[model samples]
Every structure is written in structure tokens, then in C-alpha cells.
Target: MGDYTDKVKTKMEDLIENEKNQWIDLALKIHENPELSFEEHKATQWLTEPLEQAGFRVKRHLLPELPTSFFAEWTGTKAGPTIAFIAEYDALAELGHACGHNIIGTSAVSAAVSLKKALDDDLPGKLVVIGTPAEEEGGGKILLVENGWFDDIDAVMMFHPRDKTMIFRGSLACVDVDITFMGKAAHAAANPDQGISALDAMLHSFLAIKQLLPSLPASANVHGIIRKGGDATNIIPDHCEASFLMRAKTREELHSIKRRVYDAVRHSTKAIGASCTMEEGLIYAERINNRVLGYQLMYNLERIGVEVDSSEITTGIGSSDIGNVSQLVPTIHPYIKIGNAITHTPAFTEATKSPEGMAGLIQAAKALALTAFDLFQSPSLIMQAKEELRQTINQRRNRL
Candidate 1:
């Protein structure tokens, strides 16, 4: 640690404490007025307001395809690495802020501001606050990466509110598949032989998927919902639609499992005399938790009196768009413990507004600032992270 370490950390704490209320208000306000994925206009405005005011050059709606997405950046002092704090503000359907993105987005903004305020002209590198929306459904960060948004970033960090805090927890690679079946429509009583039943084809596909499930690896998941069954009870359905999500520890595993699942759907549709069309979303790759970068966050969180989860890591964690970002560069998606409730629940929504949630937000902000400070202070940290990512890629390649 450098001599300025303590000074920088103290500055972060002081600045965060000084403006704690304003950040808390931001989180609570977002929680009160939740916005769904790809529809976070108000959230974009609220989240970018402080960053723009802090002398950061703000760019709104960076993805014209996603009007809610934005990013703010600041470069200070000497040339060095560019570190980003990812912000997710999209809410869940009906559940509203049950996922605690309100806290995630505001804490990121507060952390960037604290770092800028503390370092001022002494700041060693570029600072960025990336406004990523639609995490709940559309995979906004995934789209951003596709458009070269993360090309210049050195290290990316974000803290999620969870029941347990893990520094290097993993996530699955996942994809959404929509399957549609088409068949001839006819009056059931008058022309039973003239109809090809789309419902029957869909049911056959479901059965085939169920049969294929046991053949899949234990790490993989295949689940789906039937979106459209039939329009009328007496008529042979002309069309049917269903959606399924496939997940595995990594993209390699997901690819194999996805192939089998789709094969089953195709063969099933053919057996039932129906044609099918399938639409697949972007693949959210498994999270590569850069061990080197994770340590910075773990140390900072521990220093702040938060018990970091150091257990032998468990698999089967849910997927995130951050997982997609992780594949591109060194990243850390640390979890901050807020309450006992798991995410995507009414209780979790309440926790996001509770005192405990506010405390977690402050601690998370400080951790983010301190970790960024450590990275800027030591260029070798970035090298180590990049090397770790390189090794991970080689290992994954060999496995594949």
C-alpha cells in the first residue's frame, strides 16, 4: 500500500459521509418510482444528474437502440488506466425495484463522485460511470459490449445487493429461446382430418425437452413457459408459441445443451406435422471474476467491517449481463449484504429502502472508490488482472 492509500481512503469516507443523504435519497426515489427494462428514462436522468454536475462529461442514450442507456466520464492528472463503475437501474416487471438496481445505480454514482472529489487534480486515471439499463430482461450491457462500449475500459466494477456477500462468486451463461409452431387451422367438429394441430406440436416439443433434461449435465438448466396455446377451444390452433432459457456454467456447456434442446424441438415439430421458428437472444457468458481485481474489493469491504464471503465458491448462481461484460475484460461483480431477504422479492424491495440498505450502499460506495484508488495507484494491478483474464481464456479454450 502507498502512503496516499490512507489519505485517499479517508477522503472517500469523508466525502461519502458528507453527501450520504443525497445518495440515499436518490436510491429511495428510484425505488419509489420503478422503471422496467429498456424503459428507464427517469432513472437515466436521476443517475446521470450528479455525475454530470460533478464536471464529468456526460453522454446520454449512447445506444440509440436503447434510449435509456448513457455513460459519464472524467480524466484527471496523468494518463493511466480507465476504470468504470457499471450502473443498472432497470426494475423488474410488477415486482418493481425487487432486484435492488436502485441501490446498484445510485451507489455507483456516489462512488464515482466520491473518488473524483477526493482525488481532484491528483486523480491518476480516467473515471467512468456507465448507465446500463434493462438488466432485468434486455441485456443492456451485452448490447453495449457488442457496440464497442467496453473497448477502452481497463477494469470494471459493480456491487450487487444480495443476502450474502461474495467477492468472486460465479454466474451461469444463459440464453432465451423463443419457439413458434405453425399448423393448419380448421373447425374441430366439422373437419377434424383437415387440421394439423399446433397445440399438439407444442406439447410434443415440451415432452421431448423433458425427456432430454436428464441427459443434460447437472450444471445446465432448461425451463420454459407456453406463451400462446390456442385462440379458440373448438378450432384447431394455427399457431403456438413458447419460450425457454438455457443456462450452464460456461458458454461451451451452454452451447452443447442448447443444441440438444433445440434439436428436440425441431424433431418434435416435424413429427407432429408442424413447422417451427426459433428466435434466440444474446448469450450472457459466464462471469470471469478476476481474482486479482476481486482482492481489491474484498480487502476494501473487509476493511470497512463487512464480512467477506471466503468460502469455497459455490456454482449455480444466476446469470447477469455483467457476465457478458466479464468475458470481454477484467471485472468484479461483488455482492454487498443488505438484508436476509433474497433478491426479486417484496421483502428485498423494502430492504432497499431500509436503514440497512442505506448502510450497505455507503459501504459499497466506499469499497468501489477505494478499490479504484488502489488500481490507479498501481499499474501492475491492471497487468495482473489482464494476465488473469488471459489465463482464464486459455483454460476455457482447453476445456472446450
Candidate 2:
């Protein structure tokens, strides 16, 4: 395989290296001007500029609901499998680029662009770069999948910038919920007996969740904060709102957790003579990393001198919209080490544009490009990937 594929790998590496400065600058520019989810206008513009220049038929705001979302593709003359590089460019609210998504988006477009440059018109497959926004707040990829954006794509590839480079890190299935309680208000001291305190209902709900925690499965997690408690201490609170996120290792477990937790919240509100209303965010399914493609990517990463820690791959993980994408198609969301600083911190934000982060960016680009080439170069590999994905989906459906 080395003798057969060394030429393609060399060309991929060369293409990435030749345009390293441009890609690195793109990452830096995005890091310098951070945007929140669903609002990545500048980041989207900067990332897609090079793709359009490289002759990709870029489609901006592909999803009507998400104006920042985009789909860019460069089709070869010959018909072949469609391989997509998913790009995420959303930043944390206050911490800016703490999650290192700047690198994720940059590396994806860099890979797609590099592959276009290296393979040119002789490329056997169709290449696409999806400018997916809002991995941090909204589930942009989830929306895309629901709207039939990935229906035609055969396989998808992308890497995340993290503290440790893991080959097959998994993400928990998660959902965000907002609970509101309504009650009657009165002066605290003057007419305490006449008021029904919404704050008390909210407090009871929190206690109910904490007390129920020990009984839940080890993988279950419920964390939240009081978004609105009261306007003034002198009056009995008439309205309150709290937001919470629930997570589990799989979507099945998540359903059970949500049922029990929501029941507890409802009973608590009823006990307090308060009416409750709840709203939920998109459900981020547990990630299913395609092993056949994962190993193929591991080969490329190794060839580039980047050591992949396969053992700790499942260790530290949160939720992301990519989890939804994995459920639909063969996907891999590997992580590359930039620094010891964990994600969503000021330290992590600084490390995004650090020299180490840039190094990860370049290696990720080459590996992604090479992996895409590996699939396009051989029909057997694509068959194996599609088969694995089919079996995984069937198994999941059986579980359901």
C-alpha cells in the first residue's frame, strides 16, 4: 500500500505545505475575529473565499433557516463518489475561539482546496466543503442533515483541535432544555400568604434533580443554571426560568434520562402550585466513528509523523452536531493536539492560534485530504466504508 499510495500522499503533503501560510493566516484571521453560532458571517466569508477562487461552485446560505450555513463543491468530469469535508467555525460565547473550531474549519477547507490543487481535473471523486455553522450553540449540522443536505454524500471527514489527538473519540448524546415556572406575585413582607412563589418551584426542581442523580445511570448527566430567578427580593417572584442540558452515552439512554428528569421537574412545579412550560434544543446523537475509515486515516496521520493515541480515543468527550451527521453517513471526528489547555477556556482560546495549533492544522489538512483520496482511489475501500455504516445503522435500528 505504501508504494501504491506514497505518490498521492506526497502530493497531498506538498500541496498543504505550499499553501500552509495561506491556510494558517485564515485560521488566525478567524481566531482573531470570533463569532457565535449561526452568526459566523466573517468567518464563513474568509473560509470560503479560497474555495471559490479554486473553482468550487460555492452555495452560500444553503439552509434557509441558517443564513451562515453554506455548501461548496468541486465536481470532477468523471462520475465518482462524493466525499465531503465538514467545516465548523462557531466560537464559544465569551471565551471566543476557546474550542479551536477556527482550526477545524480552516483545516477542512484547506484539505478540500489542497486536494483540488493536487488532483485537479484527473480527480476521480466529487469534493465538497460544507461550511456548517453553530456547533457550539445550535446544531447546524443536525439542521443540515434534517433538510436532506447529506443525502447524496457517501462519506464525510473532519478533525477537531483538542488537547490530545485521539483517533476515535466519541461524543455523548445530548439535549438542552429550558424550563419556565409561572406563579402569582405579592409583596414579600406585606402579603406573603397571598403569593405563590415561582422561585420556590424552581428550587424544588433543582433539588429533585440532584436527589435523583444518584439513581440515574453512571453515564447520565444533568447540568443547568437559573436564567431568571426574580426581579426583586422585596417581592415574591411570579416568574422564573432555568436552562438545563441532559446527556447520556447513547440516544436510548438519553430518552430515559429526559423522561425521568422532565417528570421530576413537572411534579416539583405541581407541588409548588406553579405551572411550568419547557422547551428543548436539538438532540445531538452519540457519535458513531467509522472504523474502516478511521484506520485509513490513522495510516495517513502516522505517515505524517503525528502519533495518534488510539487507546484514549474514547476518553474526554462532549456533544456536537457531528454526532447527528455520523448517524446518517460514515463520519470521523478525530482530534489533534494543539496544547494541554482543555476546550472552552481562555487558555484554550489562546492556544488556537499558537504555533502548536498551526502545526496540528497543517497535519490535519494533509491527513484529511489523503484519506479522501484513499476512498476515491479505490472502490473496495468505499464499499467497506458503506457496508460498515449500513451494519452500524441496522444495529442501532434493532436497538431502537
Off by over 4 Å in 2: 2-4
lDDT of 2 by residue, 218-281 (tens): 9999999999999999999999999999999888899999999999999999998998999998
Residue runs of model 1 more than 4 Å from their true location after superposition? none
Q: List the residue pairs that clash in candidate 2.
A: none
Q: Candidate 2, after superposition: displacement of residue 2 in Å?
A: 7.1
Tell me how far the alpha carbon of residue 104 in candidate 2 is from the true structure, in angstroms, after superposition: 1.1
Worst 10 residues of 2 by lDDT: 309-318
lDDT score of residue 240 within candidate 1: 93
Compared with the true structure, model 1 gives a TM-score of: 0.97
What are the RMSDs of all candidates, in order? 1.3, 1.8
| Clash numbers, per candidate | 0, 0
